[model samples]
Target: MKTQKLKFTFLVFIFSFSNLFSQYTEIINSNNPGFSESPYSVGSGVYQFESSFFLKNLSTNTPTSLDNSWGVDLAFRTSFFLERLEFDAALTFQRDRLLGNFTNAYTINSGLSKIMVGAKYLIFESTYKDKSKEIRSWKRRFAFDTKRLIPSIAVFAGVNTDFVSDVYKTNTVSPRIGILLQNELSNYFNVITNFFYDFIGTNFSEYQLTITGTYNFNDRWSWFLENQTIFQQNQTNTSFAGGLAFLFNKDLQINTSARFLREAGNNGSYITLGLSYRINRHVDSYKLLDENGNEIIDTPINRYNNKRKGFFNRIFSIFKKKNKGNKTRNRGKRKRNN
Candidate 1:
């Protein structure tokens, strides 16, 4: 009986712990060394930064030009007010040399190329079953959960400004919108997809699609493969990249990746090195529970003064009540016998 009671208490603790941290994680969740964004947000009160530097080379046959460039891309992300919402800003700076094929003349230019600010809100999230409650068969405990197929969905809205150098400015401000989706196939594998319409109502409008797959080798090491495609009025471009990431600690990570690009009469490639770091200040809210493992609704008067009951305290209180009832029944029996 004691063993059974202990097991029951353990299960209740697990359930309560999971509920408390549905959105927050002990480790920082970052999107780095890849172009695609994640559907999930950094938890509330988290400020994260991800940055990368890369060198790219492209040659175009139609334009008869050779481009060699290096750039740094930086993103800032944070969540506040709501756990499902996140705001982010991105900036890119690049220096490039453009060579004319006919005259063999080359010129170099450098400055900020892009600036964007955006917000993402998770619209739908799917939950999985708790397999720990199953006890009859080992096979049932280890079987796949079908509910993993339904992906979590999010929406993004942002504005792009042309506060850039003359060599790379469009002179127009436009709105960008996207849908982000993610499927958690298993404990170790995840897939993410994003669709975006960029530069709305502008001369350089385009559509983009990105698909990425990530696999975790262990707690500290992981790998990702991604493909991004861009479609414009006159041409289409596609790129494929693969990367590896290592988690140095709970709040820091480093990564490296290489990409191959293809377009109509154009080809290019780039290599990137990046890192992600975060400042975590999240605090879990307090919850009160009864002996039966049901939550006690909080009243405004006592909500601020009540403290959460610990595990041992709950167990002791339950057993103490049972003991008192047993003693009362024994006393009544003795009185009847006399």
Candidate 2:
């Protein structure tokens, strides 16, 4: 009767444990691809690769010069585990052609235009406005809940070096600081905004503001629109862009975008083809599967820490202990009978 009771109690414990853990939600990292970046971090233990190719045409007055340029921008980013800090490096390569009676018309310059490296840290992240707050205690510290109405805020700083210093005959390093804020209005809509300040060498400073919104039509298709404005001491420039992002799966995305620049001295437009990819980053949902392609019941404690055993292991341990106790009792009885 005692053995039966122990067996019954173990079964009850397993069922209750599974139910409690099944309620937790896994927060997927925000991967926004467009002209503007999202305030959210790429997530810990994750490496992201983003690359874009753009072709632009500009026409300027005074000497009446027309310029056509094509470039590639490549960036890589990585984050630490459970910490809201990310590191990134970026490079830009462009080839430019000038015409229309400029001093040196029809000249082509191709090389690296810009090189930058930066770090971003999340300062504060609000809890999900819904039931996420109530269950926050059960979740891992690393996961971010996207269902929140409140926004996530982060700050970033970087140094940009001019690669073509010889072309303009000026060598300078530009330092930049920026703040990013991101929020999800719903499962279908999200928004990110950025405020930036750039110290351009010893002579001038540039301030910029950018806002972007993304709309999801479904699991595979999404669209985004963005507007950016730059303010210098004596001039201001505004740019607008829109694009479509296609998710081949959760880890890979392809996008194409077009932008128009409105500047006093020059007006121009550019089109970009880009892709973002994540490496070796698996979702929390994958914990539901065990080794042998069998489904396993995950508990809240063991969900984040896979080194710990699941519900089945706990059940077997209980049975093994009970059997050992029974065997010891049986041996005592045999000695008494002898």
Q: What is the TM-score of each candidate against the true structure?
A: 0.82, 0.67
Off by over 4 Å in 1: 1-17, 61-66, 130-135, 291-295, 298-338
Q: Write the per-residue lDDT of candidate 2 for residues 1-338, one digit (tens) a residue.
A: 87876676566556544443321213323344465676666665667888888998887653544478898989887776544678888888888786646465576777887778888888876545344445556554335554565787989899876655356323677888899888877657888889988865546688999999999898788899999999998889898999888888777888888999887668899899988777845333233433333345676656754654766776677766443343433444445554
lDDT of 1 by residue, 230-292 (tens): 999998989999999999999999999999988765789989999999998887764555447
lDDT of 2: 0.72
Best-fitting candidate, scored by TM-score: 1
Q: Where does the lowest 10-residue lDDT sum fall in candidate 1?
A: 321-330
List the global CA lDDT of all models: 0.86, 0.72
Inter-residue clash pairs, candidate 1: none
